[model samples]
Target chain A: MKTLADLKKIREKAQEEMKLRGGNVRIKIVVGMGTSGIAMGAREVMKTFLEEISNRNLTDVLVTQTGEKGLSSMEPVVDLIEDGKPKVTYGNMTSDKVKKVVVEHIVNGRVVSDYVVATGN
Target chain B: MSLKRIDLLICCGSGCVSSGALKIKERFHEVLQEKGLVNEINIIETGCMGPCDYGPVMVIYPEGIFYKKVTPEDVEEIVSDHFIKGRPVARLMLQDEEEKTFSTQKEVPFYQKQVKVALANCGYIDPESIDEYIATGGYEALGTVLTTMSPQDAIEVIKKSGLRGRGGGGFPTYLKWQMVHDNQAEEKYIICNGDEGDPGAFMDRSLLEGDPHRILEGMMISAFAMGATSGFFYIRAEYPLAIKRIKHAIAQAKELGLMGRSIFGSKFSFDAEVRTGAGAFVCGEETALINSIEGQRGNPTPKPPYPAVQGLWGKPTVVNNVETYGNIPTIFLKGADWFASMGTETSKGTKVFALTGDIRNTGLVEVPMGITLREMIFDVGGGMSGGHKFKAVQLGGPSGGCLTTQHLDVPVDYESLKERGAMMGSGGVIVMNDEKCMVNVAKFFMDFCVDESCGKCSPCRIGLKQMLDILTRIDSGYGKEGDIEELQRLGEAISKLSLCGLGQSAPNPVLSTIRFFREEYESHIRDKSCATKVCLDLMHFHIDKNRCIGCSLCAKKCPVSCISGSRDEKYTINQLPCVKCGNCMDVCPVKAVTKVPGMHPEVAAKRLAETKLSHNYDE
Candidate 1:
């Protein structure tokens, strides 16, 4: 941080971290925690994701929280982002459904199309 | 990893947050994880997107689908239909006034009409995270200036952009920078005028809170260009959020080596600090702000040595407004010509207005400079609220004048507004309706001026009080015949003899209202009545005999029992005993109760005709 070179080095490190965390990353799970979403069982859904990610020793998977997705009534909405691909959204999720998703989608790389709310690229 | 197929930008501005935007983000995470669709789509929380009334707003990028008023129930439909099915939910998309759905933010009338140079990254990037800012090419402007551009070259670019001070006075920013640069003082200073004291104006506060790094970069450029060793952000204590965000941005920039010693490896070094004002409106004036920063009384010194000549402990300094500084990073990123190309020939670049009051869309709007007030009210603001007619739009915050419907078509540039007795001071455009009394509006501003008056000069100090007394007397139905003439006289004197901008522009609201809505003042004076039926003293409550149902409810409900009649007979309000409290009007089932001015049909007819005339002008 003393000189321009130090800033450049930090920037490189930041870019590396972004590369590890961005679209090219293995998997990203974002849960909507808007006020209404949280009121409608979204917090439990988020907890299930944390439990599933760690319990299965799943690596290359990032779990994050976002503000309202502007679709509040469908609270407890989750967006699954595969590496360098489109996002798959699932709504009205439960802990059992989440465990099945971890086994079928995250591990088996199978698209659970029936439970999906939408697909976005 | 730097590239995401889909980027969902959620507006986390104060307005959206109040309407539950935060919970929506958390829901997205929970649902996405359970579905095993994580990390592919990036959800970035951004600042204000201007459409505040339509809160909990979001714009999904790449496709840029905008959604509004989202609730937990609709999240599933949006997730299934738009995300998994690869189809955007039509019902969730933002609907314009015409009921036509807008897929992207650019398609919305409020945003499409605007050319956002200053607010380019606002509501698009995370304000707290410097990496987000850098990803959007933020500090690259500073690096460009420090690495290659000279102080002279940078100043020339700003001068060429035709960017004036956005605070109040439309003074050229580069000229001020040049003045401080030309000075031979060993140390010069750059003071950012963030003490936005204008009532009903929060554009500066929003920008500071939304994109603090932009202002920092702008300040850093000014410091480098002016050869200043130190800089200060003279933000007011009223803006606690803005202060916190800016403080964080400064710390982040300093840590990343974009601020402090040898910025971008150049030999030049400039460091900035925050100085909070005690929330005095007049302290927004440059010299007063400088005095406050120097730990002295925030009284403005006269303009022989202007702040550019001698400022901040008696050194050469350049003072620029927060919005003015917000433009610098963009001017460098996109050349001066690019900046100059958007606005009018004279007033280049975009202007951010905190559009509030009776306007339907009350939020921050940054339109190109030459856009007419008509477009701002109708196209962007979605017209007047509650079906009320547009009467006058008060611009320039407390220091500005009220522009009537006749002036709506005028191009909103510095010269046009000044010519109409309104100066484009700070960007607080309050769209008033027919319900608002002009004289009362003038009084409100004059009262503000009186309270904020530093009492330095006789014209601004004593003269404003005399004018306020006249306005009060006029508004209360005790006005004399020559009261209007006396107010005009005092207004001119104050403008001529006042020491600072506060004194000089103190008479603006009064003078402008008098000029545009003269009939309101005349009715108040000649008829001892308010044209808009606002003043209580001039009203006479009467029940229309034709429409009366003879319920006698008004009589029973009257606090004073002023109305008298049998249940079957048409009720009449006894004018002598009537308190004019408007209870009878409120209680009347058949809408029989009406208030006429001065109990005369002819006067009422005349006022009705005047109202009709103004309504015609509004359309």
Candidate 2:
């Protein structure tokens, strides 16, 4: 039902959103939802993420899913990104960790040092 | 000033998830927020990056830094050091064992030699998002084809590329396109054969799941070239995630007017649908696949009319495997010369392989054609798993043959592999170490072929079953002197008379193994011995009294209770009760139990000498 103009409008709107969201937010959370991760319960991790973010009223974090990186043994991986900092990846995430991540890391001004897989330090 | 955005990629593939990648993500979020830098960076979960051994891997972009063996506990150091202070943590970075220095992913030997083409978009894009796909230039090929190139022109480009099919047959892809193009059919069909049935292969499934739009775009380009109005994706039902992603891609394409009638405002109109296969291995064969699509029994018919001439409801059809279709858009976009420059003289473009078995890096890899098997098996595959001595490698699935250590330097192209008694059958490179028994490897592949034969023709059905029976008998220490000769004769007969590819190439494993390791077969037949100790029947369990700790672990753990002795004394294996199940060998902490050939040592040595003499004679 969409005409050429409508398609163009949609594209323009998408571009606008990209621009607005592009440089504004500093943190990106990448969730591993590849077949292996999904099979190993990545869905529950993602659900807990959405729930925690919504409940805590945090607006700065952006989440997305990606493919497996060939470690089929340890899945349900998550990568955290902050501006001017090297990316930190964490493995074996659970719902409890999701809540802790949101409240302790996103809300407070401290990195939860215990759960880090790799830190720039 | 606003914080600059950073990209973090986490491996979510099946292997890493089982190792707990999800919990790590949650912990990452907590650490990021606690630092009050949640808005400064971005985390993205991605697909398999192919180094499966040290998995739950994470890679950072702009720098392409690779980290291995990530656990939930290491997140904060990653945040504090890498994310906040702009430094990489050396402990987590993959290290070159010999050099003892942290290496970037590209610098690592395992990834340095790999030329990823079909796997190009695997870890880069968000597979589930249509917009992300569009952003990465997904359907741009279809648009270019529709807007500028004619159907004939598209076919010409494919022919110019000299791209042989990746789906085992090694047929020229453009020739197939040209035949379908020239065929006089009002309604033609394009079929994507995604029924990847090989045991160690998963490249096709990963492609569909990670980049479904690429295949869709390739098919759309092909449809435009061949005047085909409808296409079908004949994928197996085993890949549920791949299926779901493909279905989503199709819907998204249609919504963009890239699939339905008058695509991109051009007269070209094409649509696609999915058809699930019932997990039949034989259905991977083209004719058998055609039969399955037609709602008939999944058995192959003799080729002459060929699918291009007459196929899929008696209409002209072009059936291309998933990998071949995956290459189309890239070929068109990059130009034929660009692609043709990478590989050897005859076989142009890179080939994707599922490198598995006794290799340290057991996952998907794509390398340029004409790369030596040695390079692939050792450099890119990370050598044998657990540092085992490399013995042989099985290229091309069950229908393929074993390549010994002598032929390790053979260039992995269609012609070279074929000349070396193997085919590039969908690029399944399963490395085997010294512990693997050649006789057992042959038997294993033969057994698979027999089980999956579809019983359509006698050569494949009866011949394969009979050959397997002989092999089983030989491996079980029951072969007579002439069993090797009989095996060769039977294998040649089956190769000659088989109705389709399944029957025709079913004897390849047996023939190639015999050709390369005839001595091993002779040892099995003449001396009733298994050199690799893999054949249980040909081996006898013996206790090494010197190494025996007099612990009851071996006797207690033995399923057959073949060992009998007092706790203070060395155990003795009752030859009658020993099933050769190897339970005693596996359970013994002191490594007291061992498998010795039942044949006399002199007889075993003479058989080995005869094998060497025969090999030289054949050469």
Candidate 3:
């Protein structure tokens, strides 16, 4: 707080805390939290995504939950959204699959077609 | 978990707080706790989010969904469906004038047209939290000024920014800073004028309450540039919340070493304290404000030594309005050209207006300079409310003039407004509809001036009272020929000869109405009628035979029992006995009773005959 560097440090730290409020983000990870999705372990998948994103210090990435993306058969579904690109829906998501999705689709920009249930603009 | 999955930004600004926003917040907390989602969800109380007409407003982050008029009862549904179930509540979203729904705060038409410069951190951050202000790039301006720029260089940057005083006068800000900087008084001071007493204006109050830290930073920057060692915030006592928040902000800033000696390890140091005024309208004038702060009666002194030359116990000082200081940090943070790029030729950057009256979206708006009144009223303000048509707009409070429909297209800048007979006083824009009587409007502002006049100079004390007398008789149906002319003469004399700003501009409301709405005055004087029926003395209530449908409701409701007729025939009001209280007009179920301007036909005829007989006798 005494010097210029201290302010910059606090700003950087606070900006991370304030990131979710921002409209513009590099990536958004949406997990379906409908009753069916939660019954099928969507909560575990969502937590795993948050853990991975936070562990890697992904400041520009956000993890949010939405109700009923409607494909109950693909319960525990997750959607990877990036600006100017089609939203990629990963079906039958699990704690095991969240890591691969974060690494391939999020960190490396390689869509995992094996788990892809849908691609929408 | 550094970040909550959902953030509920509930507006706790004074406007929203009065509408039960705090209760809504408590209900949300209780519901969230019951639902076991308290940790994942965050509820933060922020400042004014504009659109105060539809408060208490809440904005949910991540999705940026905006909910208006939220009640405590609605909290359970919002927490369960929106928070836990992740589905936004659709019914509570904002609807624009066109009946189009808008969910996100950014997409709302009221917000889209606004450019928040002075209000950058107002609704967005928590005012109590200095870290939130810093997170939004707050005191970095002070840091930069203290570390990199010399005092002269800092003043030059402000001069280049083209930020004129937002307080009303449109005086170039850097000139004041330079004058204070040049004066080598060891105990020079800076004062933030928060004594905003304009009717229908809360722009300064909102800034002080919403972003106290920003104003503090602005004061610090001004102090640094002007070489002032200490400062004072002269806020009116009426704005208790604003005063409390500002005092709290000063304490926090002092705790952080942003205030007091040797700030930021630099040689430059600045500090400030809060002083509350007794809510006198004239104390907003700089000299009067200084006197009030000096514990004297708030009467303005004549200018030879302006506040910049000698102020605050005869030391060189700078007094800037709260909103004027609100713009300073941004000018330093963003370069001068960046600040200058937004506004008109003479007036630069944006203006924060407390838009009120008949406007649909009544709240605080900070729009770029040169935006037309049409855009401000229709686009940003969401047009007129209650199915009323636009009549005229009162700008700059009692000190400012009214602009009519024809002037709607005029660009709203300092020079343009002044050219059209209105000064851009402290930005209080009161929009009037056709239902408003122009003469009455002028009288209302004049009455305010009469009450608030410090009674220092004869022109203000005696002259303004004379003008108000003319206006009073004109509205009271006792007007005569040449009354309008007499008002004009007195108004001109007062504007020219009054001692302080309060007296000099007190005649503006009357003068401007005379300039733009002269016909309303002529009608009031010659016809003894108010077109809007606002002056009850000048209007008569009568039941229309065509629309009455033999309704006896008017008869029952008339306190004077002047209405006669039954359901078999159309109801008629006995005009002679009617007190013109318009009770019959209010109770008419079939659109029967109407207030017609001037006396009743029978009454007029009787008066005419009596006058003619009197004239014959004189002959």
TM values, all candidates: 0.80, 0.80, 0.94
Q: Please report, as a residue range, the 10-residue window in candidate 3 chain B with the lowest summed lDDT.
A: B599-608
The best candidate by TM-score is 3
Question: Looking at candidate 2, what is the lDDT of residue B215?
Answer: 85
Predicted candidate 3: interface RMSD? 1.8
Q: Tens digit of lDDT per residue, candidate 2, span B536-605? A: 8777778998888898888898888778887677799877656677888898998888788755444456
The global C-alpha lDDT for each of the candidates, from Candidate 1 onward, is 0.82, 0.80, 0.88
Off by more than 4 A, model 3? A23-26, A41-58, A82-88, A94-121, B1-3, B97-99, B546-551, B567-570, B601-619
lDDT of 3 by residue, A1-117 (tens): 578887887777777777778834799888888889888998788778777887887788888889998899998888888999999999998888889988988889999999999
Candidate 2 residue-wise lDDT at B310? 89
> Which ranges of candidate 2 are over 4 A from the true structure?
A1-121, B1-4, B26-38, B567-569, B599-619
> Which wins on DockQ, candidate 1 or candidate 3?
3
DockQ metric for all predictions: 0.08, 0.03, 0.52
> What digit string (tens of lDDT, one per residue) describes model 1 on residues B1-619?
2323356788888778889988998888777677655644677788888888788888875556889888766676776556544467788777755888887777877776777777877887778888767666677788888888899999999999999999878999989999988998998988889988887888888898889999999999989898898899989998887899999998988887777887777897878899899999989998988888888888998998887888888999889999999999989988999989887878999899988899778888899999999999888888998999999999997788889889999999999999988878889999999988888889999999999998878888899999999988887656879999999999998999999999999999999998888888898888877767777766677888889988888888999877888756788876655677898889888899987764344444665688799999999
Question: Which structure is stronger by TM-score: 1 or 2?
Answer: 2
Residues A1-121 of candidate 2: C-alpha lDDT, one tens digit per residue: 1233434444444332232133245566767766677778766776677667656645566555556645556676777888887777767788888778777777785676666665552
CA displacement after TM-score superposition, residue B531 of candidate 1 (Å): 2.2
- Residue B192, candidate 3: alpha-carbon lDDT: 95
